[model samples]
Target: MAVIPVALAGRSYEVRVGSGLLADVAGQCGKLLRKQRVPIVTDSNVAGLWRDTVATSLEAAGKEPRWLVLDPGEGAKSWRVLERVMDWLLDEEVERGDHILALGGGVIGDLTGFAASIMKRGCGFVQLPTTLLAQVDSSVGGKTAINTSAGKNLVGAFHQPGLVLADLATLDTLPVRETRAGYAEVIKYGILGDRAFFDWCETEGPKVMAGDKAAQDYAVTESVKAKARIVAEDERETTGARALLNLGHTFGHALEAETGFSDRLLHGEGVALGMVLAARYSARRGYISEADGERVVAAIGASGLPISIAALGMDADGRKLANHMLHDKKMDSGTLPFVLLRGVGEAFLDKQVALDDIAHFLDEQLKTA
Candidate 1:
């Protein structure tokens, strides 16, 4: 087992990564596990896969377990679902001292954490992230939210969890596509500030997706470690260091909105393609060489991620897509800051980018896409 700490002073917590941590959730959270029953909020898909093992573990540890299974998907991150979860937690009589377990992927984790944050002003909760996306990124950070009609994560909080249990074994049940989607976040770590790691991923990513245990462990650990360091330095993103994590997110979130936030394009896939756009745009602006931009495109394409918006059958033009970003959470004072690359392993935030220029560049891109 490897434990990576997110040092947030009074809000510090540990992200535990291992093969079978889920089966020992109760043991790991001994003191947090009270005589009262623990309430776990999950999605239908995940409930069928690992609920029994989790409940069995808590039961053996002399803790009672209560389950609330939700419908799975991006839609679940809405006001309606959030209300449902809040009502359920209140009905369960969860207290500020009780640990509400978020026992699924990012959707469940985000929803549960948001609920716990507002329940009686604030409460304790644990994150048991099942999907690779959740384990590597969402579960570790304190960013919790429900999607708003205006944009993704527009309605959320900065509530950190008490602990995070990331069991690689649970990924065995993931569909090949979901596994590949999660790999995109792993790739972001390299694109943001680690060229050597990027090279390593270029060679080892396929194997990791193919279920190579060692490779999977290495990827998750390295990604979490990178995030932990950044979060420690700039916990609330006031220093701009934490904003570097949004490498492909600005463009990616626009794609997500254009697609109506459906399965037509997964978050990570949009990110994979968004990274390509960022690289290309960076080269266009003379911040990086075209060769370097192509290198990023080649790496992402080889990983089986989308390289072109045209291929995805998106009908929205660059102007329309750029309009969507107007509501991005990263926008400040009517100026949208973009995480653009200076080269591989180097990214900077540019708040001076004109939306019109971006639309024109994207229009040219669409011609060949």
Candidate 2:
């Protein structure tokens, strides 16, 4: 097991990455499970695969696992489902001191964490992220959110988890497509900050997708460590340091909106293509060479993730797509800050970006072969 600490001043927590963390849930969470009735929020899919393991663990520790299983998918992160989760948590008589377990992917973690954040003006929650995307990215960050009509993650808060158990064993049951989607975030860490790690990914990314345990361990642990350092430095994203984590998110969210935030493009998939766009846009702005941009595209595409917006077959044109970004939460004073690449490992936030130029660039991409 690799333990990475997200070193926030007073609310610091550990993100434990390993196998059987879920099976050892009681021990992993320890005193965080304060009550006999432990409230857990998860999706039905995760419940089907992990409910028994978690239940048995807590039961063995003389704790009763109370579950609120939600319908699986992005829809669960909406205001309606959030209300349901809040009502259910209230019914369970949860207290601010007690920790609620978020036992699924990013959606579960985000929604549960948001509920906990506003619950009684802030409660504790543990993240047991089942998906690779969650383990490597969303689970560690305090940025919890739900998608609104305006855009993805438009409604949320920065509620940190008390503990995060990223059990590698859970990936065994993840669909291949899901695993590949998660790899996008995994590679993202390398692309944004570590050139050597990016080089390593160019070779070992395949091993990770192939179920190589060692590769998976290294990938998850390293990604967590990278995120932990940044989160420790800037927990609230007030500093531009933390915004580097949004390397692909701005463009990705727009693509997500165009796709109706459905199965047509998973969040990670959108991010994958978004990074490609960011890289290409960076090259167009003379920040990086054209070869380097294609290199980003190649690495993402090699991992079976989409690397082109043209391939999405969307009816929306560039202007329509760029208009979607108008609702982006990152927009400040009518200017949206974009995370663009200076090189493979160098990402900087550019606040001078014009939506009109982005529309033109996206239009060119939409016509790409």
Best candidate per TM-score, number?
A: 2
- What C-alpha RMSD separates each model from the true structure? 0.8, 0.6
Off by over 4 Å in 1: none
Question: Lowest-lDDT window of 10 residues in candidate 2?
Answer: 3-12
Question: What value does the lDDT take at residue 213 in candidate 2?
Answer: 96
* TM accuracy, model 2: 0.99
The lDDT values for all models are 0.91, 0.94
lDDT of 1: 0.91
lDDT of 2 by residue, 1-369 (tens): 998888888898999999999999999999999889999999889999999999999999999999999999999999999999999999999999999999999999999999999999999999999999999999997889998998999889999999999999999999999999999999999899999999999999999999999999999999999999999998888899999999999899999999999999999999998999999999999999999989989999999999878889999888999999999998888989999999999999999999999999999999996
What TM-score should be assigned to candidate 1? 0.99
Off by over 4 Å in 2: none
Give the worst 10-residue stretch by lDDT in candidate 1. 27-36
